[model samples]
Target: MNLLKTSVFNCLFVCSLIFFLFFLLLFPKESFNAALNGLVLWFRMIIPALLPFAIISGIFIRFHIADYFSFLFKPIIGTIFDLSNEGSFCVLAGFLFGYPMGAKIANDLVVDRQLSKNEGEYLFLFCNQASPVFILNCVAINCFKNENLFLPIFIILLSTSITIGIVLRKFFYKSLKWDSKEKVLKSLNDNTSPFEILDSCVMNGVDTILKLGAYIILFSIIVKMVEIILKDFYYLKTLIIGFLEMTNGISYISSLNTSFQIHFLFVLFCVSFGGISCIFQTASMVKNSHFSMIKYLIVKIMTAFISILYGILYLKFIY
Candidate 1:
């Protein structure tokens, strides 16, 4: 059965690639423009916003900064999420820096034997999220043109993430044991020189960012191709693009002459789900680890749904 499934998957993947190539050939101009747009976005927005966070995270890990913060974070994270001290760093990175950072940190912890596979998997679900900066600055103020929406959107996203974490901890991670304290402590005590650590961190950060950029470009092209194919159905096109790549999806939605409520809901959903592009990027980050991308995808979908529900409730009650 497993072999048959694998064969079927391979066939489907080959067919999809062939279809994509044919589409590219059919619409060369569209493909070129889309690829160019992706490049612009990578160099303009993603690089500036993401690179510093990646480098800082690398430095933090290399220098065992998490160990210092772990003492303060352990009590709260442990009580709420049933996670160890190291898990607090993943939470902090995810909340502060956003998408794939949390996953990257969890992967690093797992690789260093600071966190067990089960704990890492649990962290992967809720720790990886849209950054507050992206939500407030990019989406709320810039895209929506309403500073008032910033607090609401930020609160909703943060609350939903914490709620998901709590629920998952209570149900899924109850059976998983924490890593050995001695091993974690040993890994935290690195004797490498500061210059050497800095060099390694910079190199690793560059490699990770490059990989992220490639995924963004690939998905941007795919999303554009999909939009070209579904030209007539504007709503469907908006959703399809959003599902494939978030920034483009939000851009399309914002351009439309739609109701504020509709626009708000759509943006909320897209940001929460983070689109397929983000999923692929995160999967690449955790490929070497035992974290399950499939499970993470499910969590994203659930979070999106919850966000939609919260928006609706807020509208009915407050707005």
Candidate 2:
């Protein structure tokens, strides 16, 4: 079955590449602009938002600051999530930073042997969320045209993530505390200078952000291609675009002349799913790690439904 899946994936991947190449040859200007726009978005939004956090998160883990800080929430995350010192820290970082950061941190922790493979997957299942920045700025203000929607959107996303986390923890981790049981923690570098740690963090951060930028650029082109290729089945095209890349999908959905509730639910779904682009980004971060993309998608699908449920309740009663 795995072999069959792999074969099918390879065929689809090759076909997609061929189509992309052909389309690029046909519309060089559009592809170039798409790449350029992706780069600009990365520079303007991703870098400014991510670089500092990456560096600081690296330091936090390396110096074991996250352990101390995460311990503070032992009463809550500790007891409820039943995580270790490292996993607890991830809870905060995952929710706050969003996206691949959660996956990135989990990979780092697992590499350092501070967290076991199962423990990493436990966090990976639920911690990785859509960026609050993207939700507020892109979805709420730009797409929905209402900054006030931020609070409710936030509530739905947050509740869904936490709910999924708890459920997965029960199903996967059970009641035990997840930590470095078999995987011993990496030895602390006593001789390493603070400057050395900072330098390492900076380099890793730059590398990660660059990789993320490339994915963004690639997906931006794919979204553009979808727009150009499928003229028929307008709604089908919109769903495909949204499933592939979220920001563009939400933009397309919002531009249509629809009632507010329909628009709101669709927009809510996009943010909740975090797009195929975000999934690839997260997968990239944990490529060699124990985290499973299949499992991640299951979590995302579950969250999307949960979020829609919340959206309906909000629209029906709260909004």
Candidate 3:
């Protein structure tokens, strides 16, 4: 399953790449250049947002801040998730801090023999998704101006879906056990100043933002075409566009002059899909880890579907 998903996504990415190149070649010089300009702008937007977070996240991990974060989430994790002490820490820190960070923590746990391989994989499935801060503050508030707190409510529901789905998977497959050997945490010298951490954070965040920005720009061009097509055929654009490029799909949907319910559904779908960009990013991170791209998609898609259903139900009864 994992291999199949990897192959499919890879094919899509390659096709997009080819199409984009063709677009540059076939379009008039001025139009192609304008699209390139847009792509550059998108890169600028995405890189800064992401690069600092990535670096800071790395520094935090290197300094064992993630371990400390794990400690803080212990009570909630212990009581609610019913996880082991160490397992709870990994899960909570991953859930609270950020993406791939949680995965990183889990990977470390697996490497150290603290968490079983199966448990680590399970943690990777659910815990390594978007944090509340990113989804609500970054996407909802910043992107959509949805001060009505729609994003937060949706994220709460989305997280619940992820958790439920993961639990169900665990119930069906059962978890595998491995060695439980403990390893000492790495230490950073005190001479490392706070500025260094800040700098690293900035650099990492920039890197992440730039990558996403480039993707956004490329996707925006494709979306422009889709919009034209939708002018004549306005059904299921969100669904089709999202499967191709997630963030662009979300942005396009958010830009629609639609009703609150439609907007809600669009947001639900966008968030659930996490966009193709997110899947690729996650896949890139786990390339060497024990994580499976296919499994991640299955989990991601299922959770996304559940979130969409929840949103639909909310619209039907509550909204």
List clash counts for every candidate, in order: 0, 0, 19
Clash count, candidate 3? 19
Model 1 per-residue lDDT tens digits across residues 1-319 = 9999999999999999999999889988988888888888889978888888888877776667776777788788778886667788888788878787888888877776667888888888888988988887778877898888888998888888898898888887785566456355334336767788788888888888898889877887898887878889888888889888888888888988889999989998999899999888898888778688889999999999998999898888987
- Candidate that beats the other on TM-score, 1 or 3, i.e. the better one: 1
**Candidate 1: residue 294 lDDT (0-100):** 80
Kindly indicate the candidate among 1 and 2 with the higher TM-score. Answer: 2
Superposed on all Cα atoms, the candidates' RMSDs to the truth, in angstroms, are 2.0, 1.8, 5.0
Query: Which 10 successive residues of model 3 have the least lDDT summed?
Result: 178-187
| Candidate with maximal TM-score | 2
Q: Which stretches of candidate 3 lie over 4 Å from their true place?
A: 1-18, 28-45, 84-117, 131-134, 137-145, 165-169, 172-178, 181-214, 221-231, 255-259
> TM-score for each prediction?
0.93, 0.94, 0.71
- Single out the weakest 10-residue window by summed lDDT for candidate 2: 175-184
Candidate 3 accuracy as TM-score:
0.71
- Per-residue lDDT tens digits for candidate 3, residues 1-319, read 9999999999999997897677656654644654676576555544444445566555555555655666777687655555555677666656655554566666656654556666677777777665666666656776578766654455555565556635755584354444445344433565876677567656655655555555556555666556545766554676667666655566667766788677766666666556775666566555445677778788777777777777776667765
Q: What ranges in model 1 sit over 4 Å off?
A: 175-192
